[model samples]
Target: MGRKNDIASAVIMLGVALFLAGCPKQALEPVGAGGPQPQAQPQQESPAMTPEQPAMQMEPYGGASGQGAVRLDQARQDFQDADIMFEYDSFSLTAEAKKVLAEKARFLNAHPGMKVLIEGHCDERGTAEYNLALGERRAKAAQEYLVFLGVNAQRLSTISYGEEKPLDPEANEAAWAKNRRAHFVITEG
Candidate 1:
C-alpha cells in the first residue's frame, strides 16, 4: 500500500508539472494588435463528431440510447443475429446455439455494465398457450446457458413473445425458421 501511494503521488506531481508547462503564453498576454489576435471563426461539427451522435450509428435493433448505447445496441443485435436455431417444436438449443451463446457470453463479460432482455419467439404452429410456454422455455434455456458461460444472472431478464412477432411474416418454411429463435434487447449500458 505504501508503494502504491508513492507511485500515485509521483504520477500526480508529474501530471501537474506537465500541465503547468503546457500553459500558453499568449493566453497570459494582453489582448491587443501587438499581442495575440482573436482566433478564426469555428466550423460546424459534423453529426458524427457530436457527443450525442456516434460515428458508427447503426439501425437500433431495439429501443436503447445514452452513453455507449450505440455500441451496446450493436452488440445486442449481433448476438440475436447469430442464427441460434432450435429443432422444430423444441425449446432446447442446438449445438449452433451453444456456439452463439459462447460468443455472447464473451461480449457480455467484456461489458459488465450492460443489461439485456432475452425475448423468446416461436414459429406459428402450436396453440397460443403452448407457444407461450415453449417460448418461455426457449428464453430460459438461453439465460441458463449465458449464466453457465459466466455472465451474471442479475444482468439478464427473459420474456416470452411466443408467435406474436416474426422477422419474416410470410407463411412459409423459410419464414417459420426465421421466427423460431431468441432475440436480444439492451436495456442499459
Candidate 2:
C-alpha cells in the first residue's frame, strides 16, 4: 500500500511537472480508467446540400432525459456486435468486410472519444503458433485499414486470441467459418 502511494505520488508529480513545462492540456487526457471525456466545441453555422453526404444530426443528450445516452449505448453495442469476418486461412479483407469496416470507421469518426480493441480469432484447424500469427495479421490488417480511414491510431489497439475462443465451438465448416473473424471490443469511450 505504501509503495503504491509512493508510485501514485511520483506519477502525479510528473504530470504536474509536465503541465508546468507546457504540455498540451488535451494531450494529457486519461485513458481507460474513466474513458474519454467529451470535448465541448463551440457551435458553428451550417449550410447544407448534397443528398449523397448526410449532415451530422444533433440529438438531445444529458440533463433531464437520458435518450442520448441510451442511443450511444446501443450504438456501442452494435459496433462491437458487428464482426469483421475473414475467409479461411486468409487475413485479407473481403468486399463485405470492407463495407462493414467503412461503417465502423464512420461511427468511430463520429465518436472520436472511443477507444477500440480489435480481437483476432481463428478456426481450430491450424496449429497454435500458426493460428496466433494469423490472428495477429488479421488484427493488424483491420487496424491499418481503420487508420487509413482516418481513425486515430492511438485510439485503437489489437490482440490475438487465436483459436482459443470461437463463436461456434462445433467442429464443422459452418462453425469454422463463424470462428474466422476479427471481433471488435470497446475498451473505452
Candidate 3:
C-alpha cells in the first residue's frame, strides 16, 4: 500500500509539472523577475504618506484630463466608419470582415472608456425567428474576434436586429450581401 501511494504521488507531481510547462512563459516565471505584477502591488497607501500629499495617480484611458475623453470620442467615430459583412445565412467572418475587426480592436483597445454595441443584421430571406438567431450568432462571432484581438470584453455588447433592419430593402443578392453585416454603435465614450 505504501509503495502504491508513493507511485501515485509521483504521477500527480509529474502531471502538475507538465501542466505548468504548457502554460505561457510569463506565467511560469517568478513575479518581479521582468517587472512588477499587478497582483503583487500593495492595495493600500504607504504608512509614511500623509493626508496632505496625494498618492500615486494613474492616468485615464488616453491621458490624464479631457484630452483622453476627446480621443475616446474620436475613436468611437472611427469605429463606426467600418462595418463587417457576413455571407448569406452564415455567421462566419470573411477575410474582409477579419481585417475590419482587427482595426476595430485596435481602436477599442486604445480607447478603453469607449463602449460598443454590435448590432447583427440579416437579409429578408429566412423566417424572422431564424434570422434573429443567425444575427445573434453573427454579432457574437464579431464580438469574440474583437476580444481575441485584445479589445476589453467589458466594453463590448451585442444585439440582433435580424432581417428587420436591412441596409437595403431590395430583394437582390447585392442588397442581401450588403445587409448581412455586424454594425458597430458606440454606446459610451
Candidate 4:
C-alpha cells in the first residue's frame, strides 16, 4: 500500500511538472539568465524628499514616473479578476458575461500586443469527461465573444480544466456557480 501511494504521488508530481512545462510562456518580461534588467540611476529628489534623508530612490527609465508600469499592472489585475460565468450544464454566456467580456475586449484592444489564455472550469457534479467537454465549450464561447467584440482571435488560446479546479470547493449552489467560470491569463504581450 505504501509503495502504491508513493507511486501515485510521483505520478501526480510528474503530471504537474509536465503540465507546467506545457503552459504558455511567462509574462512578456524576460526571465532567467541573459535578460537585461533596467538599472537604476542616482538622481536628486525633486523637493519631495531631502537628500539629508538616508534613502535611495531609482529614477525610472525615459524620465517618466512609474505610472506606465502601475497602469499596466492595474489593467492586468482587472483583466484576470473578471471571469465569464456560465449556467450549470450550459456553455451559454449570460448578459453579464457579455458585458464583462466587452470590458475585457476594450482592455485587449488597448494593449494590442498582449496575448491571453482562457481557462474553462466547471463544478464537481459531472463526470470528468463530460465536464472537460463542457469546460472547453465555455472557454470557446468566451473566446468567440471576445472575437466578436473586435479582439483578435489569434491573441487568445483556450483550455478546459473541467471539474479539476473549482474556485469554491464547497458543495453548494453558490460554490458550484462560482466554479462554472472562464478564467483569463495573460500569456505574453
Residue by residue across 1-189, what tens digits does model 3's lDDT show?
Answer: 999999999977655443323221212132223332223323323332334222221222212233433443454566796889998899999999999999888766644556899999999998999999999999999999999998888888999998999999899999998999999998765
Model 4 per-residue lDDT tens digits across residues 1-189: 999999999977755443332221111243222222223212212332333322222221112344434445666788999898999899999999999999999878755668999999999998999999999999999999999999999999999999999999999999999999999999877
RMSD of each predicted structure: 14.8, 14.5, 16.6, 20.5
* lDDT of every model, 2 decimals: 0.67, 0.74, 0.70, 0.74
Displacement of residue 92 (Cα, Å) in model 3 is: 0.6
lDDT of 1 by residue, 1-189 (tens): 999999999977655433322222111232222332213211212222334333233222112222234344445567657756777789888888898889989878755667889889999878889989988999899999999999999999999988888778998999999889998776765
Candidate 2 clash figure, as a count:
0
Q: Is candidate 1 or candidate 3 better by lDDT?
A: 3
> If scored against the real structure, what TM-score would every candidate get?
0.62, 0.70, 0.61, 0.68
lDDT of 2 by residue, 101-136 (tens): 999999887666679999999999989999999999
For residue 60, give model 3's deviation from the true position in Å. Answer: 17
Runs of candidate 3 with Cα error greater than 4 angstroms are: 1-75
1 or 3, greater by TM-score: 1
Worst 10 residues of 4 by lDDT: 53-62
Give residue 177's error in model 4 in angstroms: 0.8
Model 3's TM-score against the true structure: 0.61
